[model samples]
Structures are given as structure tokens and as C-alpha cells.
Target: MALNLNDLGIFVQAVEHGSFAAAGRRLGMPKSTISKRVAELEAMLGARLIHRTSRSFSLTDVGRDFFEHARASIIEAENAETIVRTRLGEPSGTVRLTTSVPTAQFTLAPLLDRLAARYPKLLLSLHVTDRFVDIVQEGFDIAIRSHQQPLPDSALVQRRMAAHDFYIVAAPSYLDRYGRPEKPADLAGHNAIVANAAETSWRLLAADGTLQRALVNPVMAADEPFVLLRAASSGIGITVLPTSVCATAVIDGTLERVLPEWTAGQITTTILMPHRRGQLPAVRAVVDFLLEHADAQSGVLNSLANA
Candidate 1:
């Protein structure tokens, strides 16, 4: 029997959800039915699509490539359907988005909520992490990232959402109690709640626009940005953080932006996805919403970039 589109879809889901049972649940089919479809498809192709154990399933290398190709076709079919539906003016579907914890919590989360409210049928699956995740392998529709430069992957396309403003900050209590420094060199005497150890050796642009470098030895350190921020707020030490992380606190006067006249390079926030034609309908909708909202927030980061 010829392999059917439905079976191909089942195969895609099995790879995406990582198990026959999960794929069966998503497709509203019995586990046996899902397994039978996949097995049939693999038999028709004369290649094993998955390496399966009693409890787990993983794509074979051929299966990975096949999935990429199959997903593109699936996206095209979905988009064709959407084009017809959207012409009649109704937008709906599930979009899986990923971002760092801070970006999702402080920046994208509220905007997503607003988007979801406007489009009642649209389901947004949000995955938050501080580590860089592979969107295709992870089955994510899109990702939000912050970096000093563009991602070098040719397989991925990136859209600049906004530039991020990084600030050197310390609690008022700590600065007042320990004596505020008038210059970067003076930070050597003070304690720092370090986020990145290399960040301790900070290089800043001076008032006269001269480059100034400082080698600081932090008394406290944390791998997580939030932990560093919390330590700084508790008067443990000072920290260098992005405005997205510190903006609310700065506005609330809980944490103060220190060395305002001096700052390091700006970090640009970006939206990333696999480079492909006929992208999924749901992903496109989320991307449109993000771009619109990003333009609204552009000025916030541009100021820091130009400064």
C-alpha cells in the first residue's frame, strides 16, 4: 500500500512529541494505531525512521532529514489552508515559542498574554530557558535571544527584535554604606555580585568617549543573572545587568543604575527560526505580533545603543 499523508503526519508527530503514546494523544488516535501508521511508513520507505525502546523513541539520522522535509510539506499544506481561511479573516492555531527566562518573564510574556487575549483560538506554548536551544530539534516554532552579535547558523534566520541596554547596578544601601565610586577604578575596592566572571573585567566608554577598562575581583558570584541581581539588591555587592532584568526595579527605586555615564557594548535581542519557505501559519502570526510590539520597544534599547 502507498504511504498516506496521514501516516506521514503521524510520523512527524512521533518524532516531534518523542513517543508513540504522546503522538497518539495529540492526533486523537489509539497508541496501536499510531505505531502501525509509523511502522507502515517506515516499511514503505525501506528505512527505519526511529530507534525505539519499550519506553523511548528517537529519530534516526535519516529520520531527522525526512522529518525536516516532511515538516516543510506539512507547513505548506497548513499555510495553503490558512491563506484560504485568512482571506475570510480568521486567524487561529498553536505557536510554540521559546526564550530565556528573563526575556520571557520581563519582556515577551506580557506581550504574549495580550496577543493570546486578542486571538482566542490561538494557543501559545512558551518554553523559557537561559540556555540556547535548537528550535528545530526541540520542536519550537520560534525563539527570542539576546547576544552581542547575530547567530552564525545559516540554517536559521534571525530578525532583530530590539537592542538591549546593559547597566552596571548596585543597591542604594550598599553604595551609600560602602561609599560610591566616582570612577571605574574605584570599583576595585568594593564587592561585586558577579553574573559572568569575565564581565568583572569590564570595558566602558568614557565621558570624553575614551575607552576605559577595569579589572574587578568580585566577592560573590552566580551563574544565573537573576541570582546576581538578587544578591546585588540585598546589599551583597554590585552587578552588571541588562535593562530588561533591572528596568522595573530601577523604576521602583529598588535597584539603582550605577555608572550611568559608562557602559559596555549593547546586546541585540533577536527572534530566531529555521530558514525555510512556506513557514507554519501559527509561527508567522506570532512573528508578526512580536515584530509589531518590538517596534514599540525599539526606542528603549536604541537609546542605550546610541549612548
Candidate 2:
């Protein structure tokens, strides 16, 4: 017997909507028609797909399995149609994305505005948090992250956006009172406002290419970078921060780079997607936008560094 895509879709819809009546309402078909199509599908497969009552229904074991595959097939078909439609100049879909809070605030907000202006039909659902989110399990189409450590091997496609350098900073008042450090070793005696308690050391590279680690005395520690930034700015102690987050503060004279000659470390910014194949046009558009904006920001940073 030949399998019918339409019947499969109807059966899946019935399963999803919980009954033929609800599925019929959603699909703009009569309840009787919905029931008949599902029944036809079960007959073709030679299995009882659903256990029905006068007022309710439930999927049989075979129906539950079939529903999963049928739902996927329907989605694939819709995505295929969307690909053609997008090529013809109409890209419309919701793209769910996840990223760190700091990146969202300091980097992605303006870029998202630009994306909205360019793709009026494309909608974005963005989740911003400090915790690492599982994009696949969370139903996210894309994720952006900044990490100093190497990422583990994964099936997801990874794209490097930029490298962010870390800067150790202190309020001018704190420096005047505690005395400025002439070398990394001097940091050992000073009160430190660390982002992580476990990270009580700052690694620095010297002009002669020598590397050194300075163990800090932490008076305050927090997981959030903004909290550390605020603590450092309030003269609680010296703290390390990403250059991107500290750039404006440095310019505004709220904080100054402590060891202007050295960096703590470099964090790589990366974007990830589930797969390269069958990527929706909306997803592709946002990814390209992010890469372009990241490159432009990197150029600006490089120019500032030279100056």
C-alpha cells in the first residue's frame, strides 16, 4: 500500500491536537473528515493507530511512534517549502536564540535591531542568561558564547566571531589609596574583586614574552561580571573584566586599566548552530548579520588599540 503524506499529516495533527475535533478546527477541516483521514492512514499501515471514545481519544503504541516520525516528516516538508519561498524573496519564521547576558547587552542588541529592520517578517525569541544553555534540548536555533577554555567536540557547527581580551581594572580612588602596582607580583598584596572565587590568580604576559601568575587577595567575589565591575568601580578592589565591557567605563573615567601593559587572558566569542544542512533562511540571515557585525566591531577595537 502507498503511504499518503496528507494522511500522515492528518494523523499527526490529530495526535498533537488531542482529538479529531480540535485538529479539524486547526486545519480548517470538518471533524468527520479529520477522523476519516486518520482512519484511512491506520488502515493503510494495517495497525490500530488510536484508541477512541465518544468524547476523547488516545494514541496506541504504534500510533505514538508513528506520530513522532510523521511530525518530523511534516516539518521537513514545510521547511522545504519555506526554502523555496525564502529564495523567492520572502523569508518569514521565528528564530529562537540564546546567549550570555553581557554579550546581549554590550554587543547583540544593536545588531538585533538591524536584523528586525531588514527582515520585517522574521521574528526573534532571545534568551539572555549567564548559565550555559543546551541549544538543542532547549529548542534554540542558535547560541552565542564567550569562553576562555577550549570548547569540547560536538556535532554542532561552530563559528568563531571574535577574540575578546581581558583587562584588570581599578577605580582611580582605590589606586590612589592602595598605590598602583608596578608589576603583576604587586597584585598579590592588594584587595581583589574577583568574578569567581576559584579564579584568584591573574596571568599576565610581560614585554619580554615572559608569563607570570599573580595570586590575588579577594575581598569580594561574584559569578556575574557586572557585579565585579560595579564592585571594582565602587573602589571595593581591583577586578578583571572583558575589554568590551570595560571599554566605555574606561573612557568615562569610572575605571582605569590596572596593568595597561598586560592582559589576563583572551576569551573567544563563538556562534553555534545544530547543523549546516536544512538551515532555515531566517537562521542563515541572522548568523550572517552576527558575523558581519562582529567583524566590524573587531575592526573598531583594533583601530582604538593602534591609537
Candidate 3:
């Protein structure tokens, strides 16, 4: 049966206000009309809700139980309305974000600081990992990732934030001791810090549209770039890394670009959301802020790509 919410609301108000006349005054209706609606509600449920009397108002055993549940529904409805109204204004509320470790460290996390300053009521929760996550299943409002190939197929709205390529970089001390590679062929003799233990081949693109390949001796290996980056900065060996991961170290002179004239491959930074339509204001605001600063976030690549 289709429940009459209006009748349910009137019934609850009648019990709370303690009299039909009082419920009518609060709801702006006649006492008889309020009493009739409550009666209709009781009849629809096939139960006695109120025991009406001239001197007092009372409830049946079933009526008391129903009243408790009905009042909760009314409060929830009011709160839902309040949330909608809040969203229409300042984009207030918590936005749950998930991102890869590198992007979170170098790109998205910094942009959120600016977002927080702009929207004081906005809150952010960040989850960082290297694995691909199911944003919908994981209850994330937004996701950011940097990748070399296309992201896996999904319904999420994917926006490319920035694009950059990998550069060979190492500490100045490493190059000073072992000397720097002046050409692709020179890498064959260099000690390389690689992502894995297996022998790795690097395909570099030269300045004049020539593709060159070289193999380097792997002195150390790690699956995570941050670890490899730290090793590279300690003068361990040359490593291929995207500029975003190494930009701060490079800027601070902890790491120096090697074979600056060649790029290994390109990578894209992208933002994903479960859906663009019907996103809460807070989620939308964060997405806009990310897209706005996407370039500035990756500007390190452009600055040093030619340097």
C-alpha cells in the first residue's frame, strides 16, 4: 500500500502537541481536519492509534510504537532538505578523494590546500596508494592518477590534467664520480637504478626525431618510484623518472638531469569522478580547483624539459 506521508505527519504532530486543536494550530488547519487525517492514518494501518477523550489525549500500545518511527522519518526529511540548501551555496561538506602516491605528493594534495583556503567550510579526506582503486566501491568522491598508458575502462569521467615525459636524472655527485652519459649509447656502461630486478631496456627519443635504445647495468631496484628517487639522490645510480616525482630534488640541486636532450616516454596526469552529473557542490568545487591548477602543478616539467 502507498503510505500517505501527509497523514503520517499529521498523526505524529497530534501526539506531540497533545491535542487535535493544538496540532491544527501548529499545522494551520482546522481541529476537525487534523483529527480526520489521523483517523484516516489509523484506518489505513488497520489499527487503533489514538484513544480520543473529552478531558485528555492518549495513545494505544501500537500507536506509541508507530509514533516513535514516524517522528524519526519527519526529522530525517527535514535534515535532507537542510543538506540540499547548504549545497546550493558554499559547496560545504567533506569530499573523499583517492589518488596515486606520486600525484598526491606532488600535485593534487597541494592544490587542495588552496581549495581549503577558498572554501572555509569545505573538508577533504585523502587516501593515497599506488594500486588502482574502484572509486565507487571504495566510496571516493574523486580520484587523480598519473599513468603512461590509458587508464582501465570505466564509467568514471576522466579528465587529463597534465602531460609530461620521463627524464634520466641522478645526483651531481654520482655524475661527477662516474661521469655523465652524453649520448644514448653511453647508458650501456652506466649503473642504473631500476623499478624492478629484471634487466630493463630504455627507449629514448632524441632531439631530431630519432628513436634510440640502450641497456644499463641495474645496481639497485625498487618497485616504488619514491624509493628509487631517494636512492638516486644518494648518488646510487641514474634512474628514469617523471619530473613531478623528482622536481623538488632537482630544484634543490639534490638531483641533476642527465641526458637532457632525450626523453624516455610520455605520461599523463588525469582526474576521475564517478559521475559529472548530480555531483555535490563540494565535489564540483574540488574538481574545478584541480583542473584550474593542473598546469601550474605540472609546470616543473615544462621548465626543465628544455633546460
Candidate 4:
């Protein structure tokens, strides 16, 4: 029996939307028509795909398995279309990207806007969170992350974008109330706003290649870097933060660097791609745009360091 792709698509849509009526509303078709098409699809497959009721609907075991394959098929079909369009010099597809919230706010938001302006046909879906996301499992095409340690071995391809320098900073009021730390060990006496309460210790690299670890007494702790920056800016305590996040405040004198002779540590910013083979044109375009911008930013940083 030949199965209709339209019927299969309707069935998948019904499953995704959780009801025939919802899928009909989304697809702008009559609910009865949607229901009939799904029934026809199930008949062609010779299996009961969904368990239907007057009030609700659910998928059977076979339906659940079929849904997974059907979803993959739809994605492959869309990708194939996109590939063909790309070959004709028109790149149009959705690119799902994930990154840290701070990076999303401070760095990526404008770049994405520029990308949208450049590629009017491209669609971008961005996921911003603090937790580590599994790009492959989550079906994300790209991910940008900052890591202090080397990334774990994985099949994903990684490209180093830039190195993020960290600084220990405090509001001038806090530094006035509590004398600024002259050295890394002096940090133990001052209040600290840290990312992790359990791991309040920070390793600092000195100017002369010396390493110092300081265990701080946490006055405030939060997982997000922006929260730490807020607390430190509010005169709550000294906190370590990425220079990119605190540069404006530092330049404006709202925050002063503590122990300017040392750094908290450097985290490498990297962009990860799932695979090189069969990459979507949209994905390749975004990757190249980001790399170009990152290189430009790195050159500015180099010039500043030299000056």
C-alpha cells in the first residue's frame, strides 16, 4: 500500500499538537478532515496509530515509535529541500542555536539581528540558558559555550572563537567600606559574591606565572554571572566575572578591579557544530558570520593590549 506524505504529515501534526482539532487550527483545515486523513494514514500502515476519545487523544506504542521515525523523515525532507534551494544560491532554513544567557544578552542578540537582516529567508531559534545543553540530543544545529577546561571528547566539531578573561571586581563603595584586596590571599577577609557556594575557591594566575587559590567567604551566591555582577555592582561583595560582562562598568568606574595584578582564569569561547557532512547552508552561513565577527573582536582586543 502506498502511504501519502500529506496524510503522514497530518498524522504527525495531530500527534504533536495533541489533538486533531489543535492540528486543524494550526494547519488551517477542518478538524474532521484532519481526523479523516490521520485515520487513512493508520489504515495504510495497518496499525492503530492513536487512541482517540471524545475529550482527548493519545498515541499507542506503535504510534509512539512511528512518530519518531515520521518526525525524522519530515526533518530529512525539509533538509533536502533546503539543500536544493541552497545549491540554487538561495539558503533558507531554520537554525537552532544554544548558548549561555549572558552571551545571548551581551553578544549574540545583536549578531542574530544582523544575521536576520542579511538573510531575510533564514529563520533562527535561540535557546539561552545556564545549563549545559546536549546539542545532538536536543536537535540543536549549533552551540556557543565558554569553558575553563578542555571540552570533553565528543563527535561534535568545535571552533575556538575567543578567549574570555575574568576579573575580580567590587563596587567602589564596597572597596571603601572594606579595604581592597592587595593580594589573592587578602580576598579571604573580604565578602564575596560567587557563582557556586560549595565551590567558593577561585584560582588566580599572577603576572609572573604564579598561581594562587583563594577561598572566599560568600556573602551572596548565584549560578548566573549577571546576578554576581549585579551584586558586586550593588556593593554587596567582590565577585569574579568575565571582562566582557563587566567591561563597561569597569570603564565607567562603577566597579574597580581587585588585585589587578592577577586574573581569575581565562575561559575559551567556542562554537560547536554537530557534523561537517550534510550541513545545512543556513548553519554554514551563521558559523562563518560568527567566526568573522569573533576575529574582528579579537583584533580589537589585541590592539588594546598593545596600546
Each candidate's lDDT (Cα)? 0.77, 0.82, 0.81, 0.81
> In candidate 2, what residue range of length 10 has the lowest lDDT sum?
274-283
> In terms of lDDT, which candidate is strongest?
2
**Tens-place lDDT digits, model 2, residues 10-58:** 8877776577887786567999999898878778788998999997688
Segments of candidate 2 deviating more than 4 angstroms: 1-43, 46-80, 87-90, 276-278
Off by over 4 Å in 3: 1-89, 276-278
TM-score of each: 0.77, 0.73, 0.70, 0.68
- Candidate 1: worst-modelled 10 consecutive residues by lDDT: 274-283
- Quote the lDDT for 302 in model 3: 74
Ranking by TM-score: 1, 2, 3, 4
| Stronger candidate by lDDT (1 vs 4) | 4
Instruction: Give the per-residue lDDT of model 1 (tens digit) for 1-307.
Output: 7658777788887876678887776667898999998888988999998999897688899999999998777767766887887887646777778888878877886686689777777888888887868676566778888888767865677888877667788899998898887888987888877766555677777657888887677888787777877888898877888777776677677887677887755688888886542176667777888888878766655554354
Residue 126 of model 4: what lDDT? Answer: 91
- lDDT, candidate 2, equals 0.82
29-106 in candidate 3: lDDT tens per residue? 999999898888877899999999899789999999999999777767645755886767677777878888877877
State the lDDT at 172 in candidate 1.
96
